[model samples]
Target chain A: MANKLVAHMRLPQPISNLLAARNIQTAKDALSIPEFDLMTLLGVDIEDVRDALARISKVASPPYQTALSLLEERLINDASSGRLPTFLKGLDAVLGGGIPFGVLTELVGPSGIGKTQFCLKLSLIAALPMSYGGLDGRVVYIDTESKFSSRRMIEMGRNSFPEIFYSEGMAQEMAGRIIVLHLTSLSEITESLQQMKLRFLQHEVKLLIIDSMAAFVSGDNERSGSMSRDHLLNCPFSFLKSIAEFSCIPIVVTNQVRGHNNDGTSQYSFLGKDTDNNSEKFMNQVPALGIQWAHAVTIRLIFEAHSGQKFIKVAKSPISPPLAFPFTVCSSGIALLSDDGIEMLGQEINVIRSQGFFSIFDAS
Target chain B: MEVSALPISPTNKEKLISAGYTNLASLVIVSPIRLSRELQISVQEASNIIKVTLQCSGAVGLDGRHVVLRGAQTAWEMFSDEQNLKHISTGSEDFDGILGGGIHCGEVTEVGGVPGIGKTQLGIQLGVNVQIPIVYGGLGSKAIYIDTEGSFMPERAYQIAEACIMDTLESFRFHRKGAEDCHERMQPNYFLANILYFRICSYTEQIAVINNLNKIVVEQKDVKIVIIDSISFHFRQDFEDMALRTRVLKELSQTLMKLAKKFTLAVVVMNQVTTKRTDGSFQLTLALGDTWSHSCTNRVILHWDGNDRRAYVEKSPSLPQASASFSVTGKGIRNAISHSKRVRMM
Candidate 1:
C-alpha cells in the first residue's frame, strides 16, 4: 500500500531522460537519496519531495475510515479471545506473567544447550488447560529437519500428566492439537505460511513454531557466488516477519550459529574452515550478520552448554536483563535450579511460585 | 516481615534443653529450637528470654551431624550458610580430569551436534557410567533418559551398561543367562531402587516422568544421573513465540539445575543442528542462540569424518579446550575407532 502511492514529486522530462540513460526505471527509482537512492539518477531534489512522499504514504481519507473499522474488529477479537499464555515458573518475574499472545521469542543456543528440550516441553505445557501452566490450545511445529517424534513427546508427557501420554485416546486428541509439518525447502515454508491464517483457523492452531528460522534461508537455499542467492535466501525471513505480524500469533524461530572470526585474519573464511587454527582465534576471525537480523528479532536467548549441561542467557530481550541461568535436561523436562529438589518438585506449588523464574510478573 | 521477629517460650526452652541445648550458644546453634520455644509465647517474652540475642541470617553449614536441636534458630542460620554442590561423572578420564571431577550439581552444560553424530550416544554413555559413588568418581545413582528423538535405544543403553559393568559381575550359578539377563544384569546395581522410586520414562510422559524422577531423587536421596536424549524435539514442536519459547526453556533449565544440585546428580543433554546456506554453500550449526550458549557450562559438537566419528570441545567453562576422535564400536565409547591416529587439540 505504501509503495503504491505515486503522488510524491514530478521531474522534468529532460531529467527523466537522463535517469533513463542511467538505467533508472521509475521517478521514485531515480531518487538517489539513501532513503530514495534511485532518485538521484533523475537529477531531481525538488523541495516538496519528502513532504509529498510522506503525504502519499499516509492512508487516504476513505482508507483511514476503513482501516479504523478493521482495527476495531481486531481489538474486539483480541479482547475476547484471551489468547494463549506461556507459563514460566520463575520467568514471570522478568516477563510479567508469561509471554504475551502475539510476539516472537527466539530461543537461541549452541548445540545441546537444551533449547530443543525446552521447546518440546513448552509444546506439552501448551496442550494443557490454562490452569496447569498452559494455554489449552493447539500447536503447529514447522520442522525444517524432520526431527519431531511422538514417542519422545509421549515420554516427556507421560510424567507431567500420565493420562495425556498413556491413554490411547490422547494420541488422537493431541494429534488434533499439536501439528508438525516437515519441509526441506524455504519455499515450502513461505508458501505454506502465506496461507497460515486460514490453516491455523482450520486446525484451531494457537502456536506456530519454526524449528530453525535461519535454516529456511541457510539450509534450503544453496550458497553460491551469485549475489541473487543472498537476496533469495533473505526473502523467506521477510515473509516470516510478515506472517507473525499478520496472524497476531507468536512465531518462534531457532537460528544456527555461523563461526565468527573475532580477529581480522579469516574474516572472509568460509564456514568451518578456520578450525585448524586456534578455535578462539578462528571464532574471533568471523562476524555475524551485523544489525539487520538483530533488528528483526524482538527477543533473543542464547543457549550454551557447560560440562554437558545446558544454560540460558538472555542475549537480547526487550523485557529482561542479560543474565545467565543454569539448567538441566532430565527425564521430566528442562528445569531451573532449585535449592531443594525434594521440597520443591511436585510437593510445593507455593514454594515453586516464589522462585525468581516463577514469580508474578512485576509489570510496569 | 514485622511479625517474623519474635521471642521464645519457657516450654520451648524446656524442649530445647531436652534436645541438648545446654546454653545460649547451643540454643543459637539449633535455631529451630527457637521456633519451638516461641511456639505460643509473645514476641517480647521470647526476645527477653535468651541471654544474648543475635540475628542469624544467610547460609550456614553444620558439622554434618544430626543434632537433636536441628530445630534451633542457630542451626537454621548455620544451615543457610552451607553450600553443597553435586556433580555428575563423565566416562572419559581426560574429559573428567578437565571438568574438575565431573558436571557439578547446580551447573548447566550443553552438548550440541548435527543429527547422526552421536549426541545421544554420548548422553546415554554418561547415564550408564555415572553410577559410582562420588568418592569413587561417580554419583552412584540410576540414570533417567528423556529421549526426544525416539532414537534412545534401550538396547544401546544396555550395551553401554554391560560394557561399564564388564568386570564387576560375579560368575552366575545360572548358565541360562541370555541377552535379556545381560540387559537386566547390565543395568546399574541401583536400577531397581531407582525404578522402584524414580519411574524413569520418556518425553511423552514428560510430566509424570519428571515427577517420578523427583520422587526418586528426593525420596530415595540417591539418584544422580539424568539424560534427556534430545531436548529440542518437543520445544521445537511447540511454542510459537520466541520469547515464550525462551521463558519455557529458562524454566526447564532452571528446574533441572536445581534438581541436579539438590539431589547431587549429573545431567546430560542432547541437541539437534540446522544447516545454513549462503551463496551456494552450506554450513551446519546448532539450532537456538546466545541464551543457550551462555547458560551452559560445557559445549561439545559431534561431527562425522566419513564413517569415523569426531567430537570437538566447542566450549568448556573451566577446562582447557580440546577435541578428540573416537568410533562407535561394539565395546562402547572407545579412545579410537580402530588403529586410526588420534588428533589432539593444542
Candidate 2:
C-alpha cells in the first residue's frame, strides 16, 4: 500500500532523485521522517519537502489509537501469539509456551551458569527447519566476548535432532543460517546493530542474541567517557529495542550479575531491588545495567547453578509467578529434567527462597 | 594448540605442520631463523607467522591475504582446545585440584582477596611453578610479574624457588630409588632469571606495562604466565573519574584477553577486595564492580575461613564451584595443615 503511493504520486524530478538517493522507496519510509527534518537532512527546498510530505502522508497516516480500541486489538493479537519453546524442564509451560516472540527477553545470570548454552539453544531453535518445530529463519548471534562456538552448535544439532542434523547437508545448512557477529566495544556493537537494520530483510532474520550484553558495557562506556550517563544507560539498549520492534523479531540479550552497593551513587551500582519476593537473591548481587535496564526488558529469566543443580527462574513476567525450573544441559541441548531429577531438586523453591545458598553454606 | 587454530594461511599451516612444527606450543619461544631454515620459507614469512601468533587475540593475516580468526567458534572446539591447554600449576596440588588442574592458558583468571590472604605468595609461587619442565606436566614457560603494589619480593620468590628445587629433586630421587644421577641443574638463580619482573608504581605504568605485553611476549615467545599482582591497586586510589577508570580498565582487560588468546598464555590479575554495604550489612565484593567480573574466564576468591585461609573457585566455565583450604607455609602454597595433617613450618 505504501510502496504504491510513491509511484502514483509521480513527484518532481529533483525530489524523486533525492528520495531515491536516500533509499526512501516507499511512503512508509518517507513518512518515518518528520516534516521539518526532511528538508535539512536531504538538503532540499522547503517546497520540495512540503510536496513530498503531503503525498507520503496520504498513504502512511499517523497511528492514533484509543485506549479501548488498543485493548481490543491487543486481546486479539495476544490470543495465539507465536512462541519459541525452550523444551526444557517444563520451562515452556511457565513461559506461556516458550519465550514469546516480539519482545526483549533478558537472561540475567553470573558468568558461566549456562547463559551461553541457553542462548545457543535458542539460536539453534530459531535456525531449525519449520517442520522440526523451529522458527525456520536465520539468527543474528552477536557475541561480545567471543564466546559463541559453532562447533558446539553442530554437536548440539546432532544431539537434539540426530537424524535431521546428521543427514548430509543439514548441519552445514543450519550452521549457515545462524550469522555470528563477535564485537567487543559499544561503538562497534551499535554500529553492527545499525548495519543489521539493512541485513534483516536480506537475511530473513527471526532472532537476535547478544550472548552477554554486560561483557563490554563498562569498559566501552569508560573508554568513550564523554558519553553522558543518559547516553550510557539508554542509547544502545533503546536502539536494540527499536530494532526488535522494527523488525518484529525476538531479541534475547544476556545480562551479567553485578555486586550491589548500598551507597548506590557509584556509576555501575544502580541495581535496585525490583523482585521484592526474591530480595534474598538480590542481597548479594544484582543484574548489570541497573534499574533503567530492569524496565527496558519486557521479560526476564534468571539462571542459577548451585552445587550441581541448575534452575531457570521467570524473574519478571506478566504470565507467571517467580517460579523456577530445574534443568540441565546435555549433548542434546537443555532438556526437561526427569521425575527423579526433579525429585533430587526436591523442596528447592522452599529451601532456596527461605534459607538461600549462602545461608546453607554458613550453617554448614 | 593445533596449527589450524592459528589465524595463519592454510598453506602455511600445512607447511608448518608438514615441517614437524605441528602444534602452536612448538612455534612459541622458537627463533624465526630456525623456523625459516626448517620450513624453507623466507625469514620474513617465518617472522611474520611468529609475530602474528604472538599478537593479542592477534593481528591476523600478516600475509595480508589471510584474516583474523573469527570469534564464532563452536563450544566443542573450545572444549577440545581447553583439554589440550597446558596449565601452569599454582605450586599446590590441592590448589591445582580446585582450579581444575591449574591456571589454564588462553583465559584470564582473576584472584581477589583481602590485603594479606597470600595473594602475592600465590603470584610468586605461580611465577616459579610455571617454570616447571614440560617433561613433568608443566608449561616450562617464563613469567611476567607486573607488581602494582610493590609487594612482589625477589627474596620471597627466591625462597619459593629454592623450595621448588628441593621438591623436584626429592621427587626425582624418590622416583629413581637407588639411582644417584639427579642432575641438580634446577637452581634458584636459574629460576629467578626466567621471571621477568616489572614494578608498576602508578596506574599509567600499569596500563603501559599491560599494553606492551604483546610486543614483549612476541620477542620473548616462551613468556606464558603474565601475573598482575593486585590489578585493583592503582585503580582503587586517586582519581574521581569512575567513568574514565572504567574505560581504562576495560581497555586493559580487552588487551589481556587478546594476549591470552594469541599467545595461549595465562594472564593472572590479582585484585583487592572492597567492602560494600548492602541490605544493612557489609559484603566483600571484588574491586572494580560487576563489569570487571566478566573480564576473566575464571575468578578465584581468597577468603579467610575461620583461622584458615581458603580459596574458592567462585566463577569458572568448566570447574565446579568449590573451595580448598591452603596455608602460606614457608615452602610457598601448600595444603592447609590442621590437626592430624600438621607439618613443621620453617
DockQ of each: 0.01, 0.01
Judge candidate 2 at residue A6 and give its lDDT. Answer: 61
**Tens digits of lDDT, candidate 2, B169-282:** 767654654333324337776677788877554455555466556767887889889998878765665435776567667767887999999999999999876545566544
> Number of clashing pairs, model 1?
147
* Every candidate's chain B TM-score: 0.60, 0.76
lDDT of 2 by residue, A150-263 (tens): 888888888888987879988888889988997877788888888778776553888899878877654443312312432365567656766765666788999887654434
The segments of candidate 2 whose C-alpha lies over 4 angstroms from its true place after superposition are A1-364, B1-72, B174-185, B340-346
Q: Give the Cα error of residue B167 in candidate 1, in Å.
A: 70
Interface RMSD of each: 24.0, 27.2
| lDDT (CA) per prediction | 0.50, 0.69
